[model samples]
Target chain A: MKSIKILERLLAAIPIMIGVAILVFLFVRLTPGDPVDLMMGSAGSVSQQEIQALQEEFDLDKPLHVQLYIFLKDVVRGDLGDSFTQREPVTDIIGRALPATIELAFGAAFFAVLFAIPIGVYSAVKQNSITDRLSMAFSFLGISMPAFWFGIILIIVFGVKLGWLPISGRLDYGFNFPSVTGLYLIDTVLARDWPALKNAVLHLILPSIALGMQLLAVLARVTRSSMLEVLRQDYVTLARAKGLREFIVIVKHALRNALIPTITVLGIQIGVLLGGNMIIETVFAWPGLGRLAVDSIFSRDFPLIQGVVMIYAFTYVIANLVVDVLYTYINPKITL
Target chain B: MLEIKNLAMAFETERGLVRAVNKVDLSVAEGEVMGIVGESGCGKSVTLLNILGLVPHPGKVLSGEIMFQGEDLLKKSKKEMRDIRGKDIAMIFQDPMTTLNPVFRIGEQIRESMRIHGLFKDVKGGFFKSARKHAEKDRAVELMEEVGIPSPETRYHNFPHEFSGGMQQRALIAIGLSCKPKLLLADEPTTALDVTIQAQILALMQKINQEHGAGIILVTHDLGVAAEFCHKIAVMYAGRIVEQGRTEQVMDNPHHPYTQGLLRSIPKMSSKKDRIEPIPGGVPDLAELKEECAFYPRCAKAHDKCLSQEVPMFDAGEGHTVRCYLYG
Candidate 1:
């Protein structure tokens, strides 16, 4: 039965993926700039004949339906088409950049959850105490600030004023390191370059913080309310009556049940984090899919935009699917 | 085995400190079943929760001496109270559906209470961890069997949601009895069950009381169930025990007006009254407490003097007591 449900989810993702592909493909064309001008490096700089030749070279002269049909056909053949901007295949660009995005997004989510859950649980247990009030106040402040703005403020404080860290970018460009898996942190370790690894980590810290802080607030608030609700549950009271330690009662009994709803929210937050990364990556000059997608959009790289958007959509669907599967493990009462 | 003297518990609400339990005095001898009967919010549950140190926030035990086996439980530290709970004193709540953790197997939950008390620590005169685990599992199965669960070995793996409501209560009862507590406090143990299930649960509690010799404090609103299962009854009104005595004495001759009102309200099979007599007026709000008797506003026998003076418990014959001006 569970396998059937999983199969159904996989089947459901197909139409959604197709819908996303069609939308991104159509939307990229509606934008003002033309890829011909971008490829030529300026508008009207190249002769009409050269522009026409270039259009023919990439099949940009073809009608929308024919282009979409070719795109879909190529996608089926495991090809995302070549980048109209980068002069490399879209797949190769994604392969090189996807890990950095994954690391940033997952790292941000990991940081958010690690701190938010404990803060939430403690706030709930101590409802009106000073710590609860202060954390809640800070969460409100966090919610109010846009992530990109926060990223800039972090840059000002740590990057410029204190001069404690790099102002922007994923690494010190002068350093040479192995490119295993295209994720600098892992690649540095594989190369056994400790200094480069340290440089990569320091560069990642600001961007991850900017991306994670908003999510942390949201997760903490959700967790706090969820925990408060679960703490009042009769089972928690029963745990207390059983002479279980206060810590066990709050953490094991209450927080375990509390995490179900928090996990659901966290799943949605993953999608939010992916979207927020675009702005954050732009500010920090982080090399990730968000940065690549935005750059592709500005360059009118239709195939690249569509490719990146499709990947984002697929990731979101999978994240939600994972959360649904986790519900069963967390609470046996939930069958699926 | 247990005694509560001059217990006053209060909750700080917007209105004021709402006194929940007002200078209440009660006791239960070893192997005895003491029933505390009252309407909802009459402090029956609060009294028991206070004894368990499970009273929620903003509700403070203002002053009290809870003497259990010569130790004043109110004086014990949080750690000391934890040691006493589950091992020396166990509680079964009203709704079994809500009380049992839904995620855990019934056997694990039963074992958890005993595990907290380290029941399996000295297993077979050796502290082998695996041996202790095996013994606890076996004991959990035994508890399941003792509570009349059929095929205990097989049912031990079932979650609380898998069990029927009656069975969940039985599983909870098994947990309560797991550590072999000297005192068992049950708050409306059968209120959520059907009549037959209620009877079965009551019978099971009776068996536990007799077989294990655990003193039981049965708190319920149902006088009928109390009469059937309890040796003595304490009738509460407005957060105070208005009358208490041997169950037969209280049932045969209810002295306090509120107690009489309660007795009159119970539908009788023998009598053919067209309408049951409900006690007039709702209970007074605890916030606006006056020096005079709280029952004065609702009492059918309230006099001018009853409105002005405080009422005190006046001893009647045969260990019976009534808090009323008539008795005073």
Candidate 2:
């Protein structure tokens, strides 16, 4: 079963890579920046020989189709090449930045699901009541406000005004950790660095809130509507007739069934989040792939752009594949 | 024995308060099968839902009482009443398609009520706790097999979609009969099934009743089914029972005009008739029927008196009753 899913993801990514390669090939030529001039420093006096050499160095002078072929071959071989702006391997930059976004994404998703499931369940169970109205109102506000905007609001309220938490990046300058895992808090905890862990938590709080708040709204509203429909099923009446406790009826019977759609929504949300991270990473000044991709696109760094788009596409495919497996487990009737 | 004395039910609607079941008196012996026959919206199912305490809100029992085993059930709290449901009194709904949870394994769904009705509430020994869950599964499998599943072991993990329509109804029956409740309310259990499956399910119900002595309230619109299985029957109109009597007598010699019309309307296989009788109009509006005999507007026998005044129910004979101006 696991192998089947891996095979499915591999198949899905192939088309996505082809589509992305075409886009990267087209967009790089359309953009204004001359890679040769940028590399040679337009501010200083440079010869045509130097310009031609630099263009050939990165194989920039190749025809569009050939360039696409080279990029595809390198991508398949797990080579993302050097960054035009950062002057480092694009993969190393991505590797260093991934944990920050991952920490934010997982933390936010965890918090969202933890709070949303209960709130959605209660709002659905107590539908048309004051509690339901309140949850609906809150969810609307959460979804409507952009995460970056929400982050700014949080920074002002919690960091600037209330002065409760630190405002920006992951760690305090002096803080050190044992590099056991890439995650800051986990590494600090493994190293038994309590102060570093505290600093990590403080730094992660606002970004987590920014991400968690949006997913919380999306998941809760979905949970509420989905549960409302699920609760109407005759099985719920059967559950009630059986004399199971109300909570048990909702949680054990209804919620899991309701989660079928919500699980799909979560997987889709992950895809959306990967794309939205460009905005989030920029706003929070977090050195994640989103920031890297944004800087690469601005500099017309075609190779880096190709790598990021393909990776993001691949991430989405894997997430959907996982959701598919989960769907099968939740509903035994599902064939694939 | 379960006895309902002067039971009245009303729904608070947008227009006004409408009485659904009015001042009704009924009793079922420990081992009797009673049928409540009525057209749609005649409150037969609602009455059963009321008795089960499964009636939706804003639809309330206005007055009277439901006594189950010498205890007034209406006065009991939800928590206390839950203990009685599916343990002492179980119910199977009309549509088998909707009856069982679609997402659950057939065995798991069967054991849900079993576990909740305190089927495993007993057996305190430490060794028994681990064995009890397994015992519940064993019992579920046995019930499924008893209901005539081809292979209980393989089918136990299968869901509702895996079962045929007949099998689904049978599965529903298996679930209802699982705990062997003292009273079972089967509301239109055969309505959604085909004629063959319907006959099979009706026969199954009769078998369960004769073997287990589970008193049943078979709420259905089909007088033929009621005539065949139920000993006594209640025929309702709008929201009230217009005629009720022993099934043999009622089907053979129906007293009320509404009852007579309903019986004549059925297409009988024995009769060599060119055309079956068709009752001309639909059931009366429930919200408008509180003022008079609900069938008055449609009944050929109706007069000015029938329109102006409410017709009270009268005892016609031994355990027989009819509500009409003629009887009144």
Candidate 3:
């Protein structure tokens, strides 16, 4: 029954994906810059014949409808076309960059959840205490502060000032390790390379923190308020009356009920992170899909841009689906 | 088995310190069923919570010694109180729909009390912890059966939402009886249930009391329920018990004006009166309560002395007592 529901949801994503593809195809074209102009702008002397020939080479001279039709036709056959700038297959580029973004996202999500739940539960349990007030204040700052700016500050303090960590990139330039998973963290672990794993972790800390700060803040506040409401419920009082330890009451009884809302925020955050943290990726100079998308946008690489957007849309659909499934586990009352 | 002496609980609200339960004195012996009846906010539920040491935050025990079994519950540390709760003294809350955690299976919740207190810890299962767990589960199923829940085996796996209101209450009773506590504190356990269901739940509780010999302190607003279910009745008004005695004695010969008004308010089936006389005026504001009788304004027998001084409980006869100037 659950699988059938999931299948129906998957089927529903088809039209949405097509709609996104159409919108992205048109929207990218609607942008001011032409790919031919962008590619030839750097060349000092460029003639109309050279531009026309380049346009013809990329099949960009075709009418908008004809181009859309060709693009849709090729997409139906599992082809995303090639990037206008890199002249590489869009799928190949995305596949290569995807693992990097996933690694960063995993790290950020890990950091967010690790700190958010405890902070939220504690603040709720000791409501109006000094610790609650201080944590809440910090969370407010976290939610409001810009991730890019925070990323910069972290780089300056941890990288430039203290010089305790690498300032940019995922790993040291000279340290060559075979890329098994492309996610350096896991690849290093799989290879039993401790030095590489340590280096990967060190590089991950600042970017992950900078990216995860806002999510952590939002999650903590949500968890705290949700927990506060749950704790006041009759069941909590009853759980206490049942002689269950405070820990069991809070964790097993209270936390599970409280997590429903937190899971919602977490799901949306995960979707956003998976879509790619464009600014954070740029700041850290991380080789992730967000950076790829940003570069493609600048170069008017329409196919690459469309591909990234499609992946993002797909990720959001899957994230929401996972959240819905998780709801059934967290609260039996909520049917899938 | 349980004796609460001068138990006064106050909630620190935004307005001020509002006395919720003031100078409440009550006791329940082994196998006795005591009912504390009052309108909403009269602190009947608070007194029950006070006994279990589960009064919510901002509600402080102003001055009290809830002596249970022999020791004062108020003097017990939080950890000690937890050990006593559900093991020696279990509580069945009102609104079964919300009392049981919705996420957990009904059987898991029923077994939770035993698991917490390690009821089957002595089971001989060296390197086989599943044997102890199995014993616990079997006991939970037995409790479910004892509470009259249909098909204890399958229903045990169902969540709270799956159960009907009556079934939920039954499950809650099952949870209360799981640990076989010496005392049970039922806070309006059947208030949310329908009339028929209420009677069934009450009967189930009475049976549990008879079989297990656990003393019960039931808090309720229904006078009829108190009359039918309790051996001893304590009627509360404005956070204080105005009258208490054997159920039949209080029912037949009420002393307090508030108690008389309450008795008059109950629609009698055999009476020719078209309308029951409701006690006029709402309960007094606890925060602004003066040193006079809290029910003075609403009392038909109010006098100069009733307004001038605080009233004390006067012995009427037998174990009967009433807090009124007329008695004084």
Query: Higher-DockQ candidate among 2 and 3?
Result: 3
Model 1 lDDT tens row, A72-132: 8888787899988678899999887788888788878988999899999999999999999
For candidate 3, lDDT tens digit of each residue in B147-172? 99999999989999999999999999
lDDT (tens digit, per residue) of candidate 2 on A229-336: 998887787777777787888898898889988898888887666656777777777767788778877777766776677678767777788788888878767867
Top DockQ prediction, candidate number: 3
In candidate 2, residue B2 scores what lDDT?
Answer: 88
lDDT of 3 by residue, A1-336 (tens): 999999999999989999999999999999998898888877657988999998987789999999999999888787899988888899999989888888899899999999999999999999999999999999999999999999999999999999988868788866667888788988888888899889989989898999999999999999999999999899999899988789989999999999999999999999999875999999999899899988999999999999999999988999999999999888899988
Question: Lowest summed-lDDT stretch of 10 residues in model 2 chain A?
Answer: A35-44
Candidate 1: tens digits of C-alpha lDDT, residues B1-328: 8999989999999889998899899999999999999999899999999999999988998887999999899999999999988889999999999999888888889889877799877776446577887889999999999999999999999988899999999999999999999999999999999999999999999999999999999999999999999999999877888899999999899999888998899888889888899998898887777768999988888899887767788999899999888987
Candidate 1: lDDT of B207? Answer: 97
Local accuracy of candidate 2 as per-residue lDDT tens digits, B34-90: 999888878888888888787766788888899999999999998998888777888
Cα lDDT, all candidates: 0.90, 0.82, 0.91
Count backbone clashes in candidate 1.
Answer: 0
Identify the superior model by lDDT, candidate 1 or candidate 2.
1
Clashing residue pairs for model 1: none
Q: Which is the winner by DockQ between candidate 1 and candidate 3?
A: 3
**What is candidate 3's CA lDDT for residue A167?**
64
